[model samples]
Target: MEAAHGTSHFLRDGVVMLGFALGFVLLFRRLGLGATLGYLVAGVVIGPQVLGLIGDAESMIGFAELGIVLLLFIVGLELAPARLWAMKREILGLGLVQVALCGIALTAAIGLATNFSWAAAVALGMPLALSSTAQVLPMLQSAGRLKTPFGERAFSILLFQDLSIIAMITVVAALSRNPADAGGPPGWQLALMTLAAIAGLIIAGRFLVRPLFRLIGGLGEREMFIVAALFTIAACAGTMELLGLSTALGAFLAGVMLADTPYRHELETDVEPFRSILLGLFFLAVGMMLDLQAIADRPVFVAVAAIGLIAIKASVIGGIAMIIGMGWRNALALGLLLSQGGEFGFVMFAQAQAGLLISPEAASLFGAVVTLSMASTPFLMMLTAPLRRAAQSTEQREEPNNDGAGALVIGYGRFGQTVAQMLMLSDIRVTLIDIDTEMIDVAGTFGSKVYFGDGTRIDLLRQAGAADAEALLFCLDGAQLDAGVLGAVREAFPRPKIFVRAFDRRTLIDLRDAPHDFAVREVMESAVTMARAALEMLGENLQDIDAAEQEYRRNDDERLDAQRAAGDYGAAREMVISHQTELAARARLRIPGRPTNRTGAGR
Candidate 1:
């Protein structure tokens, strides 16, 4: 009876929490406010201070912390060692400076403005120095700006912040230690323990993990693979906890270790759902932690503190961005996007309160300020959209040189570069335009003349000689940008023969409906090359392999046309199967040594 009652309580709480989460997320997403804001709002409404739907904020927070661990794990998986190394300048330089400056400035200001001890001020400053990875990454991704220069720098800074959490937690723990417990553990002993823990993690990851995964993978069971991944994360996290280390750091290290493994994609797919849900719960828990009564008691002070925090953080970030050579608009956007006190602030404050490092009243007031500042992130980013647009518009434009040469390439990334290089090798002069300034700069180092501007802008396209160009190539990576440029080119000057590089099958289909002389899949040549190599390894002659490949290409093109004409993928797939069967039968007949089973073998 007791077990049944406990189960019922669990179910009820889960349902209520999920209900509010889904409702708010959907509502906010529909209103273009984003799901992060929605989750936070939902938590506020259902929290103890409001409707009291969930009475156990502590329990919820305990579970929600797993979300942070998994979130960092995914981040680590996505960022390989080499990639991190490439961003070391930004991560180590900008990130360290940002944290140190913010921490010192905030610490001094807080200590002077309040009656808090220096230890308490330092603790508060540490959390304030960090920004929200969970909030900012998604917002930038949704805006399709993750590959842009500003986005890359923002991500590097956030990565540093995530790594700094380990050090910050250690500092807080040391500060919170009672002076009477001086005989506990020596500083060197603690340092040795930390080093031992790290060495053990590295050894286990290098030796034990790969073999275990290999054994599980040999079973050919995807479910077992997922189980293995979860077990790995749990074991690593639990071990770190037992060692008095950060579980998030352990999880992140585990992810980095497995990043180069073949099963990385599968692990990501399996863990993505859990990470997203748990992360949302983490956000919701943060909202529930806000002290509404405290805010009501001192509304003016709370409001002022929140505003002050944003201003201080933004100014510091903006200054750093400018120093790093970012345009004023992008610097401002970066500042606004990361001005908030992060979710970690709550964790640190809660720990401080529990350890008696900070008074409850002070924690309550600071918690309210952090929550308010976080809740304003989406609004602040939205407010900066105009500045970004104006900056884009003010970019330098080049006049169209009607006398230049062979082709006007719309994008100059990896894909476009290949096409441009092939043209140049044939002694054809190519003019390139790309929005990525970095790509343009690198291309210039190799003697490639490329303009840095949005290809979708008709004015930019015209200035690049769309009217007199021999051919126009739309090799832009972004799907929306590709389609936009295609439309703009067709409308402005339809004389130039247009060629588009389709990103995928869907893009190919979409481009097929556009006015293009040719539409090529980005990977079509690579796939053909791979197939040819496979056929060669199978002892097939070049003549036969070439014939087979040609036939296959012709059939695939016909199938694509049929699919487009019918506007039905199902029929197209069936047609492809039938065509494959016919081709196989014909091949057997053509081979003199191969037996044709037209009748019974015995007969």
Candidate 2:
């Protein structure tokens, strides 16, 4: 292909890809379904074997691979090594049970029925062992099951499952035929290469990448920070590819090493846009690969496969959850949540195809199964909530707290402490619940009433006056905690004016739309304090200060409106800063008094 011809082809390919992305984004937003599914649907629409609008998934797959790297990086950044180890009972014990037992049992049955070789069946089973991270996490988060004991256990197992995906690539590579070469590197060499790639990533991460990011960050160029993140991922992956190991493994290693770095969160924030695009493309590509024709030819086979896969997986997971001390409701929820095949299954299937370990038809069949499983998860999660409500209604007899006339606060962190202290001063009577032992101790020392307990625990809620409390406040920062506490409170006292704290704009939107009577940002108090200081420094008399502050708030509302219009965070931050500065100047010009002393402004 000539260079110009190649360039033209690339541009054409890019346009097709962008069209798929745009369509999915709109569909996802409109349907209240996740964008991941939309991407898959788009892939099916444009895929060559289907509409033939987009032929050859090679280029798109490459970008989608980048998405996988970013996704794992974000996961690693959140999952610290110590925390992973702390959840070993779940990650190792329960996780191994979920993956290995399910894999072996499912494979044995499939192999026996289809009369396929054990190897091919094993290959199929390996993919089935994986559960969709894209599907499961979002559902759990939306349903408030994320921080329940079941949620933590499920998350830990999923984390291990994610890491195991990279390992699966290596396993498939090793198992593949060498063909004419018949002289590929020995097993030891391959193992050494994998180990060396990992060690190199750790060394580079600790001694190199962090410092480079710090230097790039100092340049005060956000674009530079973004570039630095991309470079780190690509370079690390390329290095591992050169070492005859999986690029995904190398990228994951780099992420794990940087998990504890201060810049990890910033890196995650910076890479989100790219991650979304890449992940969307990946799902779209997977959708394109679905064997629609095969399903058409063997509709019965596909239907039985889908139904059988879900039923078997759900049953196995429920058994495991029950064994692990999950309540019946939680056990059922866990089973439903994990009954789907995850994206990593596609990764495994790709490696299998490249290795010639599985026939093309088999690969396509497996892909179809995985995609269907993922798509069903949202509906499954929706079902879980209604079922849980029914279960709760049938089980509970009477209100736990007949004497709770006070306000109930879940979480005794900074936000919770402030609210409790204010309530105490106002003599409104408050009951505080927290999972943090230290916070409970501190609250008691300060002569504040608090209980050390998980807010998600129904018994704990009862002890904290859930029934009689006039209001409920959730000051927890984690989404899982917030949702669980909210659900528990709602179930216990359906009529309370539930107040909650949100950590970000998305959370705020969710909270505002939620069935809460009041929703406030965790930082709103700090914002008020800063506003007071700014107004005092601007030489405004108390009377004029109040008016200016109101105007400032009004201006902020307008600024936020502009920000959502722009659809870019960098622009939004700039607009906010500009508005604050401009309003301060305008307020100062209108104020009657001279500038206040720094002490008076509490500077």
Candidate 3:
């Protein structure tokens, strides 16, 4: 009866939590506020201080930490050894500098503001120095800037922070003083334990994990594969915890080792749902942990501390970015994006509380401040958008525009260069327009005349001879920019034949619906070439491969046209599958001696 009651309670709590989380996230998403903020809001509403939905914040936190563990593991899987090695300079140099500077600065400020021992203040500073990888990376990805310079730099710093968590955990363990036992393991013993755990994880990952996974994969059971993956994460995390090391560290090491494996993408797909759910729970737990009473009592202090923390961190990060030679816009964006205390701060604070390193009153207040800072990050990013744009504008204004040619090509980057090269080879007297001055200068060095200006602007387009231009070609840097240029050109000129370069299938679909005569996908030709080469390597005749390629293109075009006409991607995808099945059937019926060449006549 007791066991049954416990099970029932668990189910009820799970349902309540899920229901609240979904509602909050959906509403917040509808308002364009983001799901992270929504999760935090949900936690606050359902917390003990408000509705008293969950009585045990600590229990929820423990479960939510699994989300972070899995998150770091996924992060590790994305970073192959070669990629990590390539960013070593930024990770160590810029990352360490940011941490040290922030820690020292924050330590001094906290020491002056409150009455706390230097050790405690320093411990607090450590967590505060770290930025939210969970928050920043996704935001950058959603904005389609993860491949941009700023995003890369921000990622480098975040990677360094994740690695530095091991050191931070070690420090916290060393500071730990058990109330029941005065003579616990010494600092050196703790350090040895940490080192031994790390070594054990490495050895196990290198020797044990890959072969085990391969064995499981050979069974060809997806359920078993998922089970094995989970077991790996749990075993690694548990082993590290037993060794008095960070569980996240162990999971991360395991992920890094498995990064180069063939099963990496499969592992990611299997683990993503659990990670996302748990991560949301973790954020919700953070919200619940907020000390509402303390905030009410000292609202002014709480507000000021949150604002001050953001200001200090942003300044430090921005300064470091500039010192590391980042452009003003990128530096500022990096700063704003990283100006919040990370989820790890809560973990460290909890550990400190358990170790009796910090007083309950101080911990409560600090936790509230951290939560407030995190909650305010999305708003801060929104505020900094205009400044980033202004910085870009200032940088663009400094570039010189010399002369115009007969044909003006927008965007002189990789795609634009290819178009320009092809046109110039034909002696078409092509002129290039680009926002990036560096690219313009590089083109000039290569004896190609280029103009620096925003192609989306009508005035700039006219200055570059849009009125008398033979044709308009867009190979813009991003999808958003391409769409903007397409809209402007269509509205202003309407007569010139417009050609666009699409980076992906989605972009191709979007452009198909636009007023453009020609939409060439950047990767199609290369992909087809590679496919044809593979076929030739497999002993297929070159003529048959060419015929196959032509048929594939024709079918793809018909499928895309049907998809656009129906306005349903699902149906279009099904049509593609059905078409492919028919092709396979036809290939199977072909005579053994003679080759079959079936072609769709429509262009």
lDDT of each: 0.77, 0.71, 0.77
Better of 1 and 2 by TM-score: 1
lDDT of candidate model 2 versus the reference: 0.71
Quote each prediction's TM-score. 0.68, 0.64, 0.66
- Candidate 2, residues 63-98, lDDT tens digits: the string is 678888888777767666656766878888888888
Clash pairs, model 2 backbone: 131-342, 132-342, 404-468
Worst 10 residues of 1 by lDDT: 591-600
Worst 10 residues of 3 by lDDT: 395-404
Best by TM-score: 1
Backbone clash pairs in model 3 (N, Cα, C under 3 Å; residues 3+ apart or in different chains), count: 0
Runs of candidate 3 exceeding 4 Å displacement: 181-183, 391-603
Error of 2 at 297 (Å): 2.8
Candidates ranked by lDDT, best first?
A: 3, 1, 2
TM-score attained by model 1: 0.68
